[model samples]
Target: MAKHIIAVGAIYIDTILTLPHFPAEDEKLRASKYVRRRGGNCGNAFEVLQQLVEDDIKLHLISVFPNRASADYAFIRDSFKVSVDLSLSIHRDNSQVASSCYVFKSQETDSRTIVNYTELKDMQCHEFIDAVCKLSPAQDAFEGWFHFEGRTPDTLVECVKELRLIPQYSGFKISVELENPSRVGLELVAAEADAVFFSRAWAEARGFKSAVECLKQNMAATKEHALLCCTWGAAGASAVQKDGGEGIWCSVPAWKPELENQSVVDTVGAGDTFIAGMLCGHCCQTSCWSLEQKLKYATDLAGRKVYEEGFAELS
Candidate 1:
């Protein structure tokens, strides 16, 4: 039987403008260049995962969008280079798609400032459960994996709980990313996941100084067999897995460009790319790799992503 991976989150139309520096208050500046693409935490991950996965494993996305007639919806649907199943997505009538505007400073360190606008309603727990049931009608159909972008905490927690009650989805593995620190109730979602990805900002906001410390202290909140991973930007990434009643921790240094003077060109979607790499290693790869190998693969892939503008040819 073929396998399926479903990613749940919002989709956005991203307008990126490159400039030498941010403009002063009330000052006008001309952008050096601009690019537009389909972007969102889940959208970006699906793009990279489609490139990494094998032919047999299928990819699906469960997101809420405007009506099919909207140009924004059409652009997002036609943007993917690889085939991704968007049939599971929900459409809203008379609604507009979410959008984000980014001002990227092309200088040392390459800083980015983003502003987002959205009026669409979030996906409710019932909607998520309905999509899952449609995808998995039979108990022995195929192995399934569900990855979530941690938004709408109340509905997300309920969604996971509801999924657990379904007999056909008992074998499915769940992973979630906690990237935004301001989003409350994410710990509840993390507790239900088989794997949890933590961002540097999320850790620091919770008073954890290092990635290792963040994983070690939070291990109690998760399941005994859960895998906890944290990414620390330039400090690299770390992971801790429970083994025979003990937690084993592994850390890897940040990957650098092979060619000298190859600095970071774009930082957008790097974290999402890392999530794709880890999922690829655990879900698509045939060999059983160690925790260290998984971290290294994800870290290297995220590092390579910074050298390019968009998520093309990353694999």
Candidate 2:
């Protein structure tokens, strides 16, 4: 049987505003439309994974949320059909949970933002214990893979350790993306993962000379683990194996409605969607496609996801 995916990451609710043209200083313009979607950097990845993979390839989204996060969180869990017994982590707090509002522009202009909520910084240890207790009924305690997005290294590593100590586990697989991975965290994760993915445009915006250089730096820092990948939006994606071998390259597949030509409903979750597609292929074991072929599967899904308006309401 195909192994399921156990995704660990964040989740959030996003409010998006689409505008015809961006507003200038002291200029107010009419908005084209507004949308609300289930998202969290971590949550969107799992959503994308479920849409791209098989029904048997289960997803476990390990994440944090505030006390009042039940409604939004439940919707995503039921929609994705993931086994959340072991992956969902709840943090109780008196404060309001974090949410992001994006103002998307049609032309070349900046969109203003209003909603500002604090990120989850603290989570109770007891919740982690409770989450593990729920995993007792799963078919395989570790039959799935691990995925982490924006999860703190210290906290996640502790969870990793705890899971490793469990005697009932079968096999565990993992792929991770660091929304804000520190040098130390990245080094630790890269060394332990089956595959690691990076977005070139996002990296470039943050001022890394080139994606290749960044991967090389990361690989050099990592002593173990092979299969490091870099996803270039329209350009495509590439992966580098360990032993300092030559790299493999693949073009990002074109979507049904070209993302460039199609109306970009919202771009926030596109990257997360891309990662979900890539991870799905790995988890399925049904994909005989080469590395590039596997990655294109993901890129195509991400392109389709953005054209649609929200966190892919996959049919």
TM-score each candidate: 0.96, 0.77
lDDT of each residue in 94-117, candidate 1, tens digit only: 785655545466553478888777
The model with the greatest TM-score is 1
Query: Per-residue lDDT for 90-172 in model 2, tens only?
Result: 65565355444454555445334434354666444455646755764555444667676635666655665566566554366
> Using lDDT as the measure, which candidate wins?
1
Candidate 1 wrong stretches, greater than 4 Å: 101-103, 106-109
List the global CA lDDT of all models: 0.88, 0.60
Model 2: pairs clashing at backbone N, Cα or C within 3 Å: 10-42, 10-43, 11-40, 12-39, 12-40, 62-87, 236-252
* 10 residues in a row with least lDDT, candidate 2: 107-116
